[model samples]
Target: MKVIHVGVGGFGKQWVRVLRSSRKVRVVALVDVSEPALAAAREAGGYNGRVPCFTSLQEALRAVPADALVCSTPPDFHREQVVAALRAGLHAVSEKPMANTLADCKAMLRAARETGNTYVVSQNYRYRPEMWTIAELVRKGGIGAIGQVRIDFHKGVAFGGFRAEMEYPLLIDMSIHHFDLIRFVTGLDPVSVQGTAWNPAWSHYKGDCSSSVVFELSNGCRVVYDASWCAQGDYCDWNGNWQIEGTKGTILYRNGEIRLLKVGPRYKVESSETMAPKPPPADSQHFVLADFMRAVKNGRRPKTDVYDNIKSVAMVFAAVKAVKTGRKVAVLDKDSR
Candidate 1:
């Protein structure tokens, strides 16, 4: 597969690296609005040998023929770039938070549907082995029907860029991963969201850097999430700390360790099992790239296809609505794929 990658900024560089390492796809063109970023990505992507770089996806597409377009641009730019790519009859893979708005997500979905091209959102957390194990355990009834889930995340990093200027930095940019993870692990679709987003006094970002959200899932599970990007003290891993409660037991995951606690006949902690961390089968992007290739080849929807991923993106938008309106908002129902 030949690919034209858009956006060569911070996160964009990661996409470039993944494309260079991919055995099934070749990045034939690089596109970015910034010339310096384009040059850096060209060197960092290790495609310095006469590969074309352009400042715009349109120009790049006009100059080259490619099987797919990888969109690593910001959320606001995703709709235009991805819709254009799909309309051009190329399969597209976009970074998380498919687009800034639900309307844009739906539009992208419609474009991909009309074009009969694969549109995948890279929710890489789903490809982790631990996440798969959690999903499998819940599916197999190891913990019975999940009733509640709690996730707490804290990280202190001074991000000095456009992210600092975006609205709801924590909820839109970071919390989407956890929201998607909740749905992925519990096999539940979000029904409603209630949340508030705020920024600490010491924070540098203009957008909210902290958030608390309560989500009601389709399966009667309640997920409570609290996160901060400006925390100063002890912090959880990038994946966050998770506590899942089910009818029969509970599952705890923190610092890359998994532990299960089951109730005893006497109402005590009967069994406790700790699982050693298992490496993923491949890099997250590799998994996403491979699935995209397979779906294109088999003419089937990929695991994180836009139709399915829109739910996760909706969760973010719904949460933002809740924060703004000071009331709960319903998540959009998934349309027929």
Candidate 2:
């Protein structure tokens, strides 16, 4: 499959490298506003001297005959680029958060539907082996009807200036991944959410530094999530700690370990086991690209298809709305405009 990638930023460069490494894909083009980044990507190989680098999407699209487009652009530009790719008769795989608003997501989905091309949102957290193992256990009834889920992604890094300057805050920029992961594991849609956010340590950033959200899913399961870009501590890292509790057992995933605790009459003592650590088959960017290529080749829907991902995007928006209005927000209906 021939693919063209947009953005070429820190994450975009990773996408290019992974796509080049994949046996199923050829990186045909690279697009970015930054000349330096494009230059660096060109020197990284696979394109050799033939890979066309463009400072604009229009210019790149005109030159590259791509079967698929990978969007690693910032949140604001996702909608326009995704719509453009779909309109250009190519399937699109977008980085997380889909877009900044429900309107943009709706428009992008509509375009993909009209074009009859697949549009995937790259929520790679779902593909992590640890999370997949936990999901499997949950699905197999090892967890026996989930009761509650708690997810926390905290980091001490200040995000420098890129995230600090955004108006949408950390939840919109980062929490979408965790929210989508919850949906992936539980296979339940969040019906309503309530959240609170604050800029505790005061930064130049316009949005809040820390946020906590509570959600009620359609299946009567409750989920609580906490995320912060301004967390301060020595041991704090980015992986995010997660715990899921069910009637039969509880799953705890932190650092790199997946632990399960089950209680039963036969075994009065709680049983515990630590899952073996396995590096992601390929980095998430590579896995997502591979999945997209497979879908393109076989004419199948990607696991993170637009129709399926729009809900996760909606949940992010709902959390943002909940934080702003200080009230519970209902997720937007899929059929509703």
> What are the per-residue Cα lDDT tens digits for candidate 1 across 54-96?
9889898889999999999988999999999988878999998
Off by over 4 Å in 1: 265-267, 334-337
Best by TM-score: 1
Query: Which regions in candidate 2 have their CA more than 4 angstroms from the true location?
Result: 234-237, 265-269, 277-283
Error (Å) of candidate 2 at residue 335 is 3.4
Cα lDDT of model 2 by residue, 208-256, tens digit:
8689999999878899888877776633334478889888878888887
**Which model scores highest in lDDT?**
1
CA lDDT, candidate 1, residue 90: 88
Error of 1 at 124 (Å): 0.6
- Candidate 1 deviation (Cα RMSD): 1.7
Total residue pair clashes for candidate 2? 0
Query: Whole-model lDDT, candidate 1?
Result: 0.87
